[model samples]
Target: MSSSEVECGPSFPELIRRKRDGGQLSKQEIGAFMRGITSGSIQEGQIGAMLMAIWQKGMVAEETVALTQEMMHSGEVLQWPKAWDGLVVDKHSTGGVGDKISLSLAPALAACGVKVPMISGRGLAHTGGTLDKLESIPGFTVTQPVEKIRQILEDVGCCIVGQTETLVPADRVMYALRDATSTVDSLPLITGSILSKKGAEGLNALVLDVKFGKAALYKDLDSARGLAQSMVTVGNGMGIRTGAVLSRMDAPIGRMVGNTLEVCEALECLKGQGPDDLEELVKSLGGYLLWMSGRTASLEQGQEALAKVLHNGAALQKFEAMLQAQGVSADIARSLCSSQCDYFLHLKPAEHKTELTAQSDGTVVDIDGMVLAQVLHALGAGRTKAGEPINHSVGAELLVILGQKVKKGEPWLRIHYDSPAPNAKQHSDLQAALLVGKADSYLASPRVAEFILPPKM
Candidate 1:
């Protein structure tokens, strides 16, 4: 069937055929499609086939917008209290190694007097997920119902939870099919999947961390920018303030990479004492969000506001409160945020640990995050497919900074693992991730490459 012949209540095969032949689906057809997904009127195999068709033929901007709106309304659309008017905001990242910014950013934004109902996901490919990192904390839960999410946000100003069965039900089915069908990279599909969940949140503003590099979804700045612009457009068109940051992801965002270790690093950042790169990312993403939400006079002022809370113990207090609100014991949350808490004693640690030393001495210039992530993923730190179990303790700690000079045989990386330590080949790959160069040749750069802002609305 051609585009014009595909009616609102068209047959499933014809709907698929129209999209497969590059015909743009009408809004009513998209809405009908979403209804089928949520009501189980559509089979999984048919959904997978349709996803492949959409991946190959692609959807126009209007079709993407319609799809997102339908998916968002497929289930419950959260209705926050009217007092939250322009205060609801959230940020999302397109997965990256050692990317734990969400762990601290949410609470920090909350400290600035905004509502953050953060609905996050699990690890995808080589990058870690926000919910997975939060799960590493003892007693921390990510499956809050909408009412409970609202309660948590009301009390603590923030809550990071995953999708409940009734929230964004359309994306839940379609998202699973995308991975199985190898259509995970489709631009319109990704936009709909991401925005549908955020749209369900009833957010006032959103910021996207579109990363590009060896370990990111997009391998170059231009491609990342394109994705950033697409999301920005759709988000703004939906009446939400939206923007994006194009960040480089060649190296890990923070010094640690693993489930529990990332939680520890995030706590350190919450306490105002972690890697500078992590701090920069939080400020950039959070600042723009604050500005777009109308909480600050300007972006710079917003950044300063976020940094002030981050450094003045305000954000830490909010994080502690949020933890307790989300099922963590008050004592454990307090100790974890205390100045002298030993993380391994409070949180779980790996069964075995080993350190890799530098083979030659020079200024550290680069660390290939992809190589490190792959090795850790093999060590059971991450999953190869959805539903696979991962070892929370499997992770790595970078001992040296990118621009720091090192001596030969210096311990540069500490690997935390279980059962079997890294085999000979894994050890070599981890060591090869480091690159040393002349001291003067190494130049530190910003993790944020550029910002993609929506047109004035």
Candidate 2:
């Protein structure tokens, strides 16, 4: 038989079987399978089976690169104008509780001369999403057509919007299957999903914040490191400058941990007055991005530049421009920045509330982020499944930080809820999540635990 009559290589099932049996897949096979996924030639069952196979038997670095590259080309790859002078950059975070870094980081970078066309997603499980937070601002839309996105980037130097249907459509299909099949934890699948969307953005450089601890997607440091390394390798292999920061997520980053509350906190950060931990995170990520794009000579210099922009009101101006470009009225945008109280009053209030106090005088050793996130979800701050509506006003606030000494009756946390009263279990869980001990036994957790550099050429 001629080469065309016999078909060139292995069939899709044969490729799946090879991977299932711990055999490596060639680049052509990977491309063929991903093309099948995008064209609907591959059935859902076969896709799920292939994902399970890859999850059980991991792919090597080369294989991962192939998968990432193929998925990236599965749909429209955006082409910016050749005359566009600014460097295009963006950031991604492994989902974490109370992580509003992107909200401020994008505009901050734009203010420093880099264009940030950020593509964001909605909240999943206990973590808050950038799109959800932006949606909290009345008239601030996350969905935009490609031409509008390009126009916003050219006009304001930054634009945060949700992924368009034409961009990385294959990743969307695969991600839904992964979520349903419990295959979301696989490193290769994660790398493919994250980079495919980011790569479609036509980024000049990328910074990743891979968080670990009780509240993060990867709960342990080692696993988080592995994921970070994988993403950095695959990202640079595909010709994008990538760096990863391993941050601690044992407790919420800022004071607030819900939708609207987080937006308020992020706004304060843009104004240069927010929680210390949150500020440190934003500066570190933004600094790396500036360095990667060659805007600064060193990381320290990048950090200093970011600080200057934040203090000189440049960052806030860029943020306001982005909001206005996205359809928010100038008056409402200023009102949101000046007084968030008026905005909160219009939303449904979490009328039923309770304060969690210290049982005895001691220092707070730890606050389990996972537990607090669960409590927030139970209070309707997050969705348990897709398509569920979230109550933006319901959440908890931390009154005490790690290593802070507390009196017996001092409030440690405040739980806000829409229910008449929190049930006994929620009350108990809230109390249990707070671990107080002797002052000498308490040790503060580092905000940025480790930094992973890009792969060496």
Which candidate leads the pack in TM-score?
Answer: 1
The lDDT values for all models are 0.90, 0.85
Off by over 4 Å in 2: 1-7, 83-86, 339-349
Candidate 2 matches the true fold with a TM-score of: 0.95
lDDT tens digits, residue span 1-457, model 2: 1211113678777887889999999888888888788777777988899999999999999999999989999988888877653388899998898889998889988899888999998887878889888877778899999999999988889999998988888898899999889998899999999998899989878999999988898889999999999999999988889999999998888888887778878888888887889988888999988888788888889888888887777888899899999988888777666634365643345777788898888899988888888888887888877778888777778999888888998999988788646778978988998898998898776699988888552
Q: What TM-score would every model get versus the actual structure?
A: 0.96, 0.95
Which tens-of-lDDT digit does each residue in 50-79 have in candidate 1? 899989998888998998899999988888
| Clash count per candidate | 0, 0
Q: For model 2, what is the alpha-carbon lDDT of residue 96?
A: 91
Backbone clashes in model 1, listed as residue pairs: none
